[model samples]
Target: MILTAIVQTKAGTLVVDLPRDRIDLEMKIRSVGIERLSDQIHIIDDEEKSDISVKLFGESDIGRHLSLLFNENYTLFDVNKTMQFVANSVEDIRDDLEMNIIHDQYDTPAELVGDIERMTDEVGQYTETFYFPLVGNMEDDDDGEQYEVGNRYLRYYEYEIRELLQKEQDLDGTNMKDYFYDDDNAQKKMVSCQWDVVDRNNTLYGKVEFRLREPFTAEEKELVRSWCIGQAADGLGEGLEQRPIETEDGDLYVSMWNSGDDYFMYDEDEMNDYLAQQQGGVMTQ
Candidate 1:
């Protein structure tokens, strides 16, 4: 018999095939590495409060047991307690059974905390131009082969800003590393955020986003606006900025304006027309 076990990691899915024979199972299990069990931790803020979560494979019976173990052993702040509990249970099994389990080795709690703190610092420093990779799977059309795909995307600073402004807390301070690194006080602080997929020419474009912080200045806002418009133009192509160019699908243009305390986004036909005029005329059909 083959016992198939699935584990999620920050990189992607990890599938383990264990034979029913105890000897073979031990041998096979011994091959498990530390890199296959981690998951990406995301922190989201909504209305001045923080929510933390991780993208991972659904739990099984063993996973549930792990959840209990984690709660008892450590504090996984801001994460879905159930998920953390399940993960911790899995770790426990790995340890007790001498099963080969893949997980990162953070020699100390401070080391784990530092890794997360660095991530938070990165999010803050690069408030604009921050990108994350969303992992998935794809099959090759020619060979019927399968492969992992990491679709990169730009995360908008606006999302975090809205979350922090409403909640008055630092979303990044959420304790993601605690659960991920198997440490205490993991749940005392957690953060949550959301991301959307982006496409270009029917192909996945790398995720990108602008990171932002509190008390945004007018200059910063304008810079973001310009950068976004430039990105749109870059994605669409040259001459897209000046005129309403029709692609195979529909008209596309960049519209920017300011409201009482924020900025707005829309497609601008006039801007496209102006661009066309600048080009001497629209592209001939």
Candidate 2:
């Protein structure tokens, strides 16, 4: 199913296409801060149609980098520009995938690439980074490739820890973005990250409740709030509805060491216990 919407503003005209069947057109209309067009927008049934006309508008330099206001502090520059950045990010993902495939072992590079593509099939927002500690002093070869013989850490063995997670995503019906990266090396532990994408599939909306651990830093508090915006972006595309929750508890935080539907809170005692359980359970490093 293809849904097309024609949008016009003081700057210019924009033609948008949603290739998904289950699309909330009303939500999308409101996302552009143009709720009045909700009723005026039209969608054509093009399932049987072989070809469709797509109108392309000329780029306007006026608001090419304009700040799209989605509530306060939840601003996006431009979708077209952002997509370019996302394209660049794909190269980075490929580079990391190549590095891991060359240094770590499991299957062919094609298989790993296919797995990554499948994992990131959705257009939702998420980012991940891999880490492997350097066990010995590193030296570059003639081809400029860094290699170490004796050290397991220098050989990029940390990625092997995620073999179970890869299987879970491939067979256990787990969401790829939700897969946790576990590492035994303390130096490599701090390099994992997963951003929560707010979608109808995961977000609790206003039902979200915060249970934060105490003695947290200001940075940790901000990180929790940042994820909220990210979750909104995942759900509402480029728009956001920032609703700050007042918590009497201490600062909120997110850790890469754990995995859950809700990742924006801290509990020192409970977290240590949860980590122990996770380590002891299925996902071990």
Candidate 3:
């Protein structure tokens, strides 16, 4: 017989796997204080925001009783207390009752929040560059283009999530402490912003960057570039950047302000050329 228990907290989730054979089931049941633990489960999550749940396997009678706690939430404090109860209950059950932790999901809020802050900082830097040239050229109206209230862009920020593994700890197999830890294996990145001119019907652009700790290979760089392009397309609901330059890896880095004037000028020239050809060398505004 096997029993599965899961405890979820604001920080993360923990899964414990318990396996016991039929021969020792009766003896283990009597030794392990399962009844005492079940009675105490109610005391957890008094605040009404419990984050824990459990599942029991084996005979129908025990499984039915355990099902009552399934999908229910419990406070972290109560969850910890329940785990201690289980640990102590199974201490004398012997090797016949095998319990192994199969899954653990943990998050480092401080590190994750820090990553967000850094991404925001990068966005700020980009915005500063965006307004710098426009501020300088505010008075210059040599081209037909003019900046109005609707020329600014909108910005969105969100976390890019992926499967994260927790770090290994120096604890025994039976200890639940190993199941909960402030560790992360995968890098956390974000698709920071999608830029579209407020009034113009231009292609939507997106920006994705990795604050990589290790240097990537040539192929890896290309992969990151492709990922950035795809993220932008998904966010914007349009295709890739209209005027992508030829580059070794890919022209993934986007300088919105630098290209703002150029795209407008290109559009104007294309329109002018089309009109000239249509009029047989005579152009009309």
Best by TM-score: 3
Predicted candidate 1 versus true structure: per-residue lDDT over 50-153, tens digit per residue: 22222223244433222222221232222233232223222213352212112333333344334443444444432323221122333455574645433221
Candidate 3 Cα lDDT to native? 0.29
A best-first ranking of the candidates according to their TM-score comes to 3, 2, 1
Q: What TM-score against the true fold does each predicted structure earn?
A: 0.19, 0.21, 0.22
Q: Give stretches of model 2 more than 4 Å off.
A: 1-88, 93-192, 195-285
Worst 10 residues of 3 by lDDT: 161-170
> Tens digits of per-residue lDDT for model 2 on 1-285?
122335554434445643211134445545656544332332222323212212222233212211111112111112222222222223325555435434543233234434455434332232222211111222343343433233333123223323322332233122222322221222122212232211111111111222211222445434433553344334212221111111232111111222345443323334335445645643222
2 versus 3: better lDDT goes to: 2
Residue 8, model 2: Cα distance from true site in angstroms: 6.3
RMSD from true fold, candidate 3:
20.8
True lDDT of residue 190, candidate 3: 19
TM-score of 3: 0.22
Count: clashes, candidate 2 = 3
Residue 282, candidate 3: Cα error in Å is 35
